[model samples]
Target: MSTLPRSLLKNLDLFRSVSEHDLDTVLQIAQTMRLQAGEPVFQQGQVAENFYILLHGHLKVVQTTPEGEQITVRYVMPGEVFGIARAMRRPTYPAACIAVEESIVLSWPSSEWDHVIARNPQFAFNALQTVGQRLQDAHTRIKELSTEEVEQRVARCILRLVDASGEQTEEGVSINFPITRQEIAEMTGTTLHTVSRLLSSWKEQGLVNTGRKRVTVRRLDDLIRLAEGQPPGGTAASKRNSVEPL
Candidate 1:
């Protein structure tokens, strides 16, 4: 835990302003778990006995409706703290967290949730900040789904991914994580066919390049124009009354 503490806590927002000594103590109680791709870290409605921090790889937070449809709430990158049901005042997990690839996470028992918070003032503030940001992002996604066209929604979804984990490439910015059109559709409240068609058109227009589990933005400005509800060559107002495809 001594060696792991400095490197893991250095860049994490949850550990903002935390002392190296305090972080070391917290890491001592954490248990590490490694998951394979498609494996679930926790299921919705499961007893929330622990909270977790993603140490490596990616995860998708998903919720299933009574109709058996799954909605992708968001993607979790490394350094994210999740499954904090105690923070939400819930006794069970609100959604399922599944690994997008091979991953590692450090988890602590829920019993320590209060002690951890009390031990570090900055941790509480950082935790609340993370939760607040998630709330804001949810609002923005809802607004986009309610008001934007399919193409606009798709574009915004990709842009969000690009902002989160994109890496510079010779061609343009590439989403560093593996993602598929189906997952994009789930995130944007659309269908796979619609997502595929939009990506295909964008590829043909030289705005993006897409392949199996990969997407690279070739012309970011043009993509932003589309996301803003203005085509690359024309201006258009956002369709406020439009409903996203099911």
Candidate 2:
């Protein structure tokens, strides 16, 4: 827990502006927890009694449809605070947070939220900013779902994840966490079969590579063009991208 103190928080926008004295108080109340890959951090509709900060690793914020389909809203990266229902004045979490990889989390009782905010006005402003950004992202996704084609939505989702947690590789940019096409379907409001067909076509087009639980963007420019409206189908992984018949 040595790393859980205020010094590390200086890198975080939410806490960087907090006074040393006020940050120390937050440190005093902070509790740390670890979760294994594929573990549930919190279930949907659970009492949002605490605020959580991701110190290490990634998670997915998801909601389940009435038919039991999982809809992935977004990925939670390290240094981000989650389970924000407390700040939003919600009694329960609207979605589940699941660890996509092994994770370390810092938590604080929601009862102490107001105390921390009063001590550090910047904290409140930061929280508002975080919530506002989240809402804005939600709005963007809603607009995409309603207006964009499925191919466009999936392409945008993959590109965003790439920007969020991608690592450079000889092959291209690989997502740092394990992800399946089914999850992509959930994120894009499509079916597994549809996602598979598109990915298979993308693979042929030399835009992406897929493995057991991985996806790598082999040609981002091509993918961006495809996402924008170009069809997919090609023979070689060429810098010159085109949509040929599979």
Candidate 3:
């Protein structure tokens, strides 16, 4: 296990607010690990022995449905802490985390968590906030699944990806990594064909551009308007109720 750099340690949510002296203590108990794309950081139901703070790259949290279909729960980005089964008191992971790109992460043994939390109560508070945000995102996704049309769901998903990991380019805002139509289907509870068709329509309308593994939003405002079921230039108040807090 490589030692974590002070810069990376300071950026982690779990360690960000700690005093430098306290951070040094915490760093002494942590180890850094690297994962390649498609690597499994941990498997669902495996003993939960460690938690992680990602320093670079992306991870996808996924659950296997009863029917054995893989459902994407969320994407974990750099500076995010994951594998919190220890905090939740689970003996094993509820979902599997797989690296979507070459990634670097800080790992702390589960046994050290209690000590760190005791020494830094703020760690626990930050963890709770992270979990709460994820829950809110899940709720928003559930609402989209239950009430929104396929087009609306895709629009929302694209917007969300942009928010999470979009990069600004001359073309527009592009989702920073590759994602498949099948994955989009799983995330939105729709069919791949539906997603592809909607994306195709958006492409024609100058709303988006798609390639084999990426999608770029050429006109985000148009997609937002479509999400609200309103015409372009609609008032924020008119769409306020329709917009779900993420």
**Best model per TM-score:** 1
Model 2: weakest 10-residue lDDT segment is: 237-246
Taking all chains together, the TM-score of candidate 3 against the true structure is: 0.89
Q: Among all windows of ten consecutive residues in candidate 1, which has the lowest summed lDDT?
A: 237-246
**lDDT agreement with native, every candidate:** 0.85, 0.83, 0.82
lDDT of 1 at 150: 90
Give the per-residue lDDT digits (tens) of candidate 1, residues 1-246.
Answer: 534647667677777677877788898888889999999999999999999989899999999999999888899988888899977899999999999899998899999999899988877887787799999999999898888899998999998999999888776788888898989999999999999999999887777888879999877777888999886752233222111121
Q: How well does candidate 2 match the true structure, expressed as C-alpha RMSD?
A: 4.0
- Give the clashing pairs for model 1: none
Give residue 200's lDDT in candidate 3 (0 to 100).
88
Model 1 accuracy (lDDT, Cα): 0.85
Residue 13 error, candidate 3, Å: 4.0
TM-scores for all candidates: the values are: 0.90, 0.89, 0.89
Which TM-score value belongs to model 2? 0.89
Best-to-worst ranking by TM-score: 1, 3, 2
Per-residue lDDT of model 2, residues 15-119, tens digit only:
888778778778888888899988988999999989888988889899988899678888888888788797788999999999988999988888888887888
Distance from true position, residue 118, model 3, in Å?
2.3
Superior by TM-score: candidate 1 or candidate 3: 1
